[model samples]
Target: MTKEITVTINGEEHTHEVESRTLLVHFIREIAELTGTHIGCDTSSCGACTILIDGKSAKSCTILAVQVNGKNVTTVEGLATTEGVHPIQEGFKENHGLHCGFCTSGMMMRCVELLENNPNPTEEEIRWGISGNLCRCTGYNNIVKAVQYAGAKLRGDELPSTEPVFVE
Candidate 1:
């Protein structure tokens, strides 16, 4: 039987009837029409479907829509503003954090949650936090740079203001 689910997405409350078996990713992408969350692997190996659930990073593909009822979800689409891009998004862009772009959303979302939880994470903490969000492209160097850039930006410090700063 289809079940009703109420969730807040990108700051908007949405109510819908979805199959209990519907994956959160499918609900976000197919029903809500938010395609920013991608489905890369079926066995939960890839973190491409990562999203901020209740201010924490969670894999949408592995989560059921009903599981997030009344919860807040933040997707890549919600990470920008009229002022400019969210620091994390800008960091990923400026640092070449993504190449194929398939894993960019997951990385950004992961870093978003990480920073919110710990704004001043060390390089080791950042590395540990993003360890689950794998990016085959760039060998994770750019990804690390992006996360650092975002951390610095969130702390009100000036970012390198350029693409791909030297190894720090």
Candidate 2:
């Protein structure tokens, strides 16, 4: 059966007729044309399709489009505004948190919720927080630092140096 559902994504309402079994990630990518939400694993083992549903991080692949009916969704594309890039995005860029870039969008989305809940998360806390999201690149050290950088930015503290450090 098909259902016409309306979901507000990135402050834009999208109404589409979708099958009952259509995954939210597919709806976002195919229907909404938001390709930033990658589909790494359809079984939900990988967090490449992670997105925010009503401001809470969720695996898009595990959710049905109908489940998010009338809800607000935020994909990676929503993270930035006309003023500037979201701190998480900047953090990933400045800290070199991503390598292949396939997992970058989902990783950053998860970080958005992480920082929202704990603006000053320790390195260990950040590690634990992003355990659900998997990144094959960057070894997660910089990902943790990226989250910390975003946390500092969100807390209005003095911004950290974005300078790259080369190890001899």
Candidate 3:
């Protein structure tokens, strides 16, 4: 038997008929067609499948689709706008925060939710906050920088000069 549930994804309303075991990640990627949220380490060890569910960060793969009814979900794709990239996205880009880019989406979403609560986070706090998310590239130095960049942005100050320049 399939149960129907209503979820608002990226500001769009979607109704899906899913089984009790269906995961939010599968629904977001397959049903919603928003593939920015990747599934990795399905055991919930790696935070590769994080998304904002009702303004809080959650592991998408760990959540069943049928569990979210009348909830607002925001993935990495929803973070941007017609005006350009979201501040967190811009921060990651400016700080050279992404390489291979597998864990980036989850990191960005975490940062978004982090700033929503604590706009100014210390380096240690930021590091502790994202300890769940793993990145096999860039050694997370840039990721920390990226979160700091976003923190600065949320504080309504200049974003410490993040210019994207690719060298040949």
Candidate 4:
């Protein structure tokens, strides 16, 4: 059976007829044509399909498109403003939070929600917040730094140097 669902995505409203079994990730990627939300794992173990549903981080792969009817969804594409990239995206770029980028989009989306709930998260908190998302390439040291960078920027603190410091 097909169900008609209306969902606002990236600040735009989209209405489509989707099968009851349509996963939110598939609907976003295939029907809505937003491919930033990746499908690394059909299982919810990998958070590559993470997105903000009504300002909360959720694995889109585990959710049905029909379940999100009349709700607001924010993909990684919506994080940027007209001015420039989102602070979280900037953090990832500045700190090299991603190497392969398969998980970067979901990581960024989760960070968005993380910062929303706690503007200033400790190093441990940042790690715990992103524990759900996995990055196969990056060692996660830089990923923690990335979230720290965004926290500083969002707090209006002086931006730290992007250059990584190494002590041998």
lDDT of 1 by residue, 135-165 (tens): 8888887777788788888898877555545
lDDT of 3 at 150: 85
Question: lDDT per residue, candidate 3, 15-58, as tens digits?
Answer: 97888788999999999999999998998888999999999999
- Model 1, global lDDT: 0.87
TM-score of 4: 0.97
Q: Which sections of candidate 1 miss by over 4 Å? A: 161-168
Considering TM-score, where higher is better, how would the candidates rank from best to worst? 4, 2, 3, 1
Reference-based TM-score, model 2 = 0.96
Give residue 140's error in model 2 in angstroms.
0.4
Over 1-168, each residue of candidate 2 has an lDDT whose tens digit, in order, gives: 999999999999999999999999999999999999999978888899999999999999999999999999999999999999999999999899989999999999999998889889988899999988888888888888888888899899987776666689
List per-candidate RMSD values in Å.
Answer: 2.1, 1.3, 3.1, 0.9
Q: How high is the CA lDDT of each candidate model?
A: 0.87, 0.92, 0.90, 0.94
Better of 1 and 2 by lDDT: 2
Q: Number of the top candidate by lDDT? A: 4
Return the clash pairs for model 4, or none. none
For model 2, the stretches where C-alpha displacement exceeds 4 angstroms are 163-168
**What is the C-alpha RMSD, rounded to one decimal, of candidate 4?**
0.9
Q: Cα deviation of 17 in candidate 4 (Å)?
A: 0.8
Put down candidate 4 lDDT per residue, 1-168, tens digits, no spaces.
Answer: 998999999989999998999999999999999999999878998799999999999999999999999999999999899999999999999999889999999999999999999999999999899989989998898898899999999999988778886979
Q: List the residue pairs that clash in candidate 1.
A: none
